[model samples]
Target: MTTVTSADGTEIAYDSAGIGPALVLVDGAMCYRAAGPMRPLAALLTSAFTVLTYDRRGRGESGDTQPYAAEREVEDLQAVMRAAGGRAALYAMSSGGALALATAAADPGVTGLVLYEPPFLGGDKEYTARLGELLAAGRRGDAVELFMTTVGVPAPVIAGMRGGPGWSTLEAIAPTLAYDDTLLGDGRVPGELPVSVPMLVVSGTASPAAMQQAAQATAAAFPTAEHRSLAGQTHDVQPDALAPIMIDFLLG
Candidate 1:
């Protein structure tokens, strides 16, 4: 484990492994180095590139400064890239892909990007307002529930998840769910981002049709983007199925 200081002076904790080009793994909502699929995916990619996995601010071992903004998260990623010899490619998951695009746009040091199913389908104004209302009222559990349901979790399944093993952790970082929401910003894919880095946008065939459409829309935003769909995968994509595709786009 290592640490980098963001422009806002927040301490970002990260781990680096394997060797070759610097490749940073960005997590989606409610995930960090310890509690996500990135670790296994990183383990596989390490054979081809140096992999950096980190706790986004307010999650895991990282600090969350007040008045969180998208730019702050961008600086956080830049800080990690600098720590990786001043340049890196990004492999971002879900909303993390939005942050990665923002970072790559700001810093030319980004060599490439591989984004898996960034949820840019559309926005629900009511959900956004309700999420803010829930969080501001300190209803963290409800906030998590709102997010889960908004993302298509079955109501009964979410009810079962409430007291499960990882439910508390999800609630603990529930505020960061708003942070992810801020990145998506009404969910319609932002077509104005000026990222020209080589890019690959992937979606799982078994995932919702909206997710696949979002992936395609996201790919269309970049001139150099390529869109691909993985068979037999869902939002919870298997690491082995993804790692090879990532390697091909990033190294090929």
Candidate 2:
């Protein structure tokens, strides 16, 4: 593990493997460097590119300086890039994809991006307000459960998960769920993204129709963007299935 100081002086912890061009992985909601699908995917991509997976602020080993803002998270990513020799390619999943896209648009030096199913298409205003209310009231478990339901998790499945092994981790980071909600911000992709930087938006074929549409919309929004659908894949896409596609976009 390694650490870098963000512009705000927060310590961001990360693990890097392999050699060659730097590729940083940004995880989505409820995930950090050590706790998400990125670990397995990073293990596979390490052969072709130096891959860095880090804990976003307020998660895992990373430190959070008070009062959150979405832009601060972008600076957190910039901090990782400086740690990786000043620039790096980014591959982000779920709401992390939204952050990566926003970063790539704002930071021209980011090089490229692989954004997989950002979940940035539709969200109700009133429900979102309720989510914020829940989080601010410190109803972390309810907040987490609300997010799960908002994302279409079946009630029974959510119930099952609550009693299972991963539930605890999910609850622990419940407060950060609001962070993701802020990034989503009404769930609509902007009409335009800064030109010149290359981007690839990917969605799994088996994911909801809206997910694939969001990926396509993302590609359409960027002047230099491509879209792909992984066959037989879902939001929880397997590492073996996703690593090669990311390699093609990030390394090729």
Candidate 3:
């Protein structure tokens, strides 16, 4: 993996591969280069794109700076963009959709966007506040549990997850959850996103009804956006189902 220095001098770790146009994969909450869906997705798309997958700051091999803000993250992606020949399309997963869209809104170098289930399901200040409380109290496991419960994870599953080996990693990155929340700002898709690039907002028909609605609302916010619902897919979208959709839209 190579590294790029963000505006704040934070070192971001990333991997770039393949041979065609550049495409950056942005992970949602609790995901990074080693722990998310991006790797397989990158592998599938590399045949058609020079896919760039990175550890968002504070996760994987990346460095984190103090007083984390969404703008800092935007700069982090821009730093990766510099490595991608100064321009690339973005495929943002879950909360990453907000960060990617914000990046495109700020940098005209972003040529296109493919957002999958951005979780624009409105904001809950109380949830955010409680999450902050749990993390501040140093109850990392509790923080992780709270997030899982909030996201509709069943109690029994979260109980099982607590005893898993990967639970430690989730606890370690619990603080970054707040960073993801910050990018979501009150959580309703922002009005008039100043992004004019061709965009596709996608959701899974198998996802919850609210999530599909959020996907629709997100598409409506972009001037040049199309909405697609993948049959029988859930929030954890299948790479095989998604890769072709991305290749077509990105290369079309």
Candidate 4:
């Protein structure tokens, strides 16, 4: 594991493997370097590029300070890019995709970007309203539940997931959910995040239409971006299914 201190003095932890251009993976809410869906993705990416996956501040082995802001998260990515020898390809999922897009707009060192299913609602209002209420009320579990429910997962599935591996992992890092919600802004307006680098916006066929539309919106916003659909895949698309698409996009 390697470490770099962000401008705010928070120590960020990252691991690097493989050889070639550096690729930094930014995980979504409740995910760290060791938890959530990125773990398997990291292993697969290591075979192609020098993969750098880090624990976001306040999660895993990373250090955190009081009074968090989205800017600090952007700086964390900048710190990792610096640790990667100044430039890197970035792959961000969910709200992490939003963060990476925001960072790329400001940081020239991000040479390329790949975003998968950033959870913004282009047409849904009620869903986001419920999520905002849960977040404002400090109902972390309910916030997650609302998100999952809005994404079209059946109520039974959502209930079952509460104690499952994914839910357990999320529960452990619940503090970041509020941060994710903040970035999403109640899923009403897509923030102006621009990218000059070659970019790909990927979405799953099984995901909600709003999510797919958000991915489309992101692709439209980028000067040089393309959209790809992973047929029959959901938000939980496994790393194995995703690795080849990412490799082709990044290496092509």
Candidate 5:
């Protein structure tokens, strides 16, 4: 495992693999470098581009400091880009997508970006209120459950899924739940991304309309971007399926 120090002196851990132009994969909630949805995608991406997968601060092998700001997470990406020789193609999912967009907007080192299903609500008041309650109560588990529910997962099925082994794994990293909420920011207009970098905004066919709308909004903000829907795919899309789309976008 290779490592780099962020501006705040946090040691960010990352694993580098494959051979080609650098491509960094940022995992969403409940994901670290080795675990979560990005792991399989990293393996597939390794066959094409040099892939850098890392744990966000406060998760996996990375270090965390007091007062977590979205900017710090952006700096983490910058650190990895520096380690990759100062530039990289980036792919981020869900809340991680929001971070990647924000980072690409701020850091020119991000040459390309691919975002999948960021859960940004346009003007959902009740949904935002419930998210606020979950965050305020410090109910990380409930927050995730609420997110899935709000996205239209049936209550019983969501409950059943949460009771499975996979749910435990997701729950283990639940601390980052608030970070997603922080990025969503009361379900208003997502912050202006307006990145000139080449980008691909992808969403699953089975994902919530709100999420699809968010992807469209994101694509619209970029001067150069395309929106694609993965037919018959869901929010938890297989990495193998996603890797190719990501590679195509980054390599385009």
Candidate 6:
């Protein structure tokens, strides 16, 4: 993986593949290049866009610093955009989608964005408090379970994951879960987007009702955004099912 320096002198590790216009992939909480959905999606889009996938700070091989702020992550993305030849389109899944959108709202260099099921439930402060408490007490596993449960994961499923292979990976990045919560700060829809840059909001046909609503509301919040739902796809959208549609929308 290659590296780029963020505004605060943190080294961000990223893998850039293919050749053409730049496209950056942002994974959700606890996911980075080695352990996330972006790998397949990146391989699928390689022919059309120079796909870039990176470990967000504190995950995978990326560097982390004390006193983390949500804006710092946004700056890390700007650095990635710069490394992508100074401008690029972004396709982000889950919380990464929210971070990408926030960055685009602040920086005009973003050409466009594609967001898949960004969790933007309002009243975020309420949960952040509890999440913070969990983290402060060193209950990392419980913190992970709490976040999973908060996001609608069934209790039985989380219980099943307790001894599963990837539970350690989830617990390893558990603290950053709070950072994800902070990204949507207050969670109310923004009054405006930066310069009305074209965006595409995507949802799966089988995604939870709240996710669908968030996607629609997000599209409506933007002056020039389009929403599309892939039939037979759920929150974990399949790469084969999603790539072609994304390529068409992006290249158009």
| Residue runs of model 6 more than 4 Å from their true location after superposition | none
Compose the digit string of candidate 4's lDDT tens values, residues 71-182. Answer: 9989998999999998999999888887888888889999899999887664456755676677667777787787666556799988988878777566556667666766
Assess each prediction's global lDDT (C-alpha) against the native. Answer: 0.94, 0.86, 0.95, 0.82, 0.80, 0.87
Q: Pairing residues by index, what is the TM-score of model 1? A: 0.98
Clashes of each: 0, 0, 0, 0, 0, 0
Candidate 2: which pairs clash? none
**Global CA lDDT of candidate 1, please?**
0.94
| Top candidate, metric lDDT | 3
Candidate with more favorable, higher TM-score: 2 or 4: 2
Q: In candidate 5, what are the lDDT values of residues 1-252, reduced to their tens digit?
A: 888999999999999999999999988776797677887888888878999999898888888875878888889889999999998989988878778877888888889988888766654567567766876777767877977776577899988987888776666556566666566665553546668888888998887677788888777766688899998788888877787888777876
Predicted candidate 2 versus true structure: per-residue lDDT over 34-84, tens digit per residue = 678998898899889899999998899999898899899999998898888
What global local distance difference test value does model 3 have? 0.95
| Candidate 4 clash pair list | none
Cα lDDT tens digits for candidate 6, 124-188: 66678989999999999999988888878999999999989989988888888888777777776
Model 1 spans > 4 angstroms off: none
Which is the better candidate, 3 or 6, if ranked by lDDT?
A: 3
Candidate 4 yields a Cα-based lDDT of 0.82
Tell me the tens digit of each residue's lDDT in model 3 across 1-252: 999999999999999999999999999999999999999999999999999999999899999998898999999999999999889999999999999999999999999999999998889898899999999999989998998999999999999999999999999899999999999998989856799999999999999999999999999988899999999999999999999999999998
Which scores better on TM-score, 3 or 4? Answer: 3
Model 5 misplaced regions, further than 4 Å:
123-144, 151-154, 157-172, 186-191
- Model 4 CA lDDT for position 26: 93
What TM-score number comes out for model 5? 0.85
